[model samples]
Target: MSLGDEHDGQTRTRLPEGNTGDPYATPRRPARGSRSLIAVVGVVALLIAAIALANRGSDTPTGGSDTTGGAGAPARSAAPTAASGVRPVTGKNGEIPTGYARDEQGAQSAATNYAVALGSVDMFQRGPREAIVRAIHDPAVTDGLVKRLDDSYSAAFLANVGLTPEGLAPSGLTFVSRTIPVGAKVKDFTNDTATVEVWCTGLVGLAGEGSTKPVTSTWFTITEKLRWTGGDWKITGSEQTEGPTPVNGDNRASMADDIAKAVEGYGGFTYAR
Candidate 1:
């Protein structure tokens, strides 16, 4: 079949050098559309950083909202507390937030956070990578996911971006891939299974001077079809759509070193409803 050309709105154009796009626009949701998710398995070498500046504060007041996946949903506040308290539960592995999300919103939180862990830069390392795969992905899909990622972050691919043999970030360089859920809504949430859609902005890139792959922020929606397995939510299957995306405002970009320092200094919070 012939591929469709990218209309300014419908098409998701991948940058020729590095991955960059508005993560929140609905990129023509074909049943099997390429979600513009140009995967970031691990950081290989010196790279650029992915930074999602908080525009909610007085500084970031462009009201950078769009109509992509979950449109007109007021927009998740940057504050820590809300009616839905879905904090991260400390786990044996690292941190897995659970408890208090009793409805569809809760389920959405669970699914979104799971996606965060699954899409983290830590997934590049060997041990943590496997643990995350098993943690968030469905058992049936785990093997297939691994195989695909292996191809996606192969030796040649890693070399192009400057990673080590197994996709480790070069020393002193910080690799970041964080998905901050703006909000979530449940189409059908139950005690067992829930379908949740998360509005998210993700940071993907490396941090350092002279880096080719600089950090970039993306706005995208992750519609998670979560299963109530392992005493918590696990992804059965998920689809990604681009946007509720907005224009790249003419904000002054941060310095490369400052970007790295900010990523390191700042702590990602446990999202609550």
Candidate 2:
């Protein structure tokens, strides 16, 4: 899916009104004007000095005298880094990854990984799609979502995207559908539930000789409301919206064979934090 565009707005500043009686002011007023100018300059100088001092502290090396214990910068606390040191899940429920932790970081990791699973090429196939839905979604919603998605990816929809009724690409081509999460955040979270938003960039289409549906990239955000169940985070619901996209770069597009080769060569990551 693709996102809509955003427009930038301009800002204008108005200057303060001039003193009306300035033209006929007394000669002594010139001294007052000088005093005022000096005051303003002093304020500016003070501001510059303060900024320089602040930046100097920031620029100091970790090994400097200011560091605690003079060993280096203070060790980063776990609160900010959130390093549990727990290994990520190495198992998969069918094609979808499984076994997420039960914290805010766990919720974020689950959401990002689920987004990748749901956006994959396998989601077009009946068996794999059902497995994925059952794997990622909460048990309460799995059946409903599976039925809805089955109806949504109908035969006509498959044909429109140049896929067979069985959801397979033609023999000569390889279908490409993969989501790469750029980042994720928890919008609302508690011990039992969380709302997570994942920003992702994806590639979708067919890669092959004379391919009309050439691979293309898109940006979007997926918001998943998750529930902690079965000792893991499972999505209760999800909605996608257009992205905070950037302007396209000047890089030249690659050939279909190269695209196919690259997809095969580079594997995707299991995201965290």
lDDT of 2: 0.58
Q: What TM-scores do the predictions have?
A: 0.65, 0.69
lDDT string, candidate 1, 1-273, tens digits = 011110011111111121212122221222333222353322111011211111111122011234444655565432222232223332323554444234444465566566566556665555666666676666767776666656565565555545676777678776556666676666775667778777777776667876555666766777777777666667776766666777889999887788888767765544433
**Model 2 poorest 10 in a row by lDDT:** 19-28
TM-score of 2: 0.69
Error of 1 at 36 (Å): 8.4
Highest TM-score: which candidate?
2
Global lDDT scores for all candidate models:
0.51, 0.58
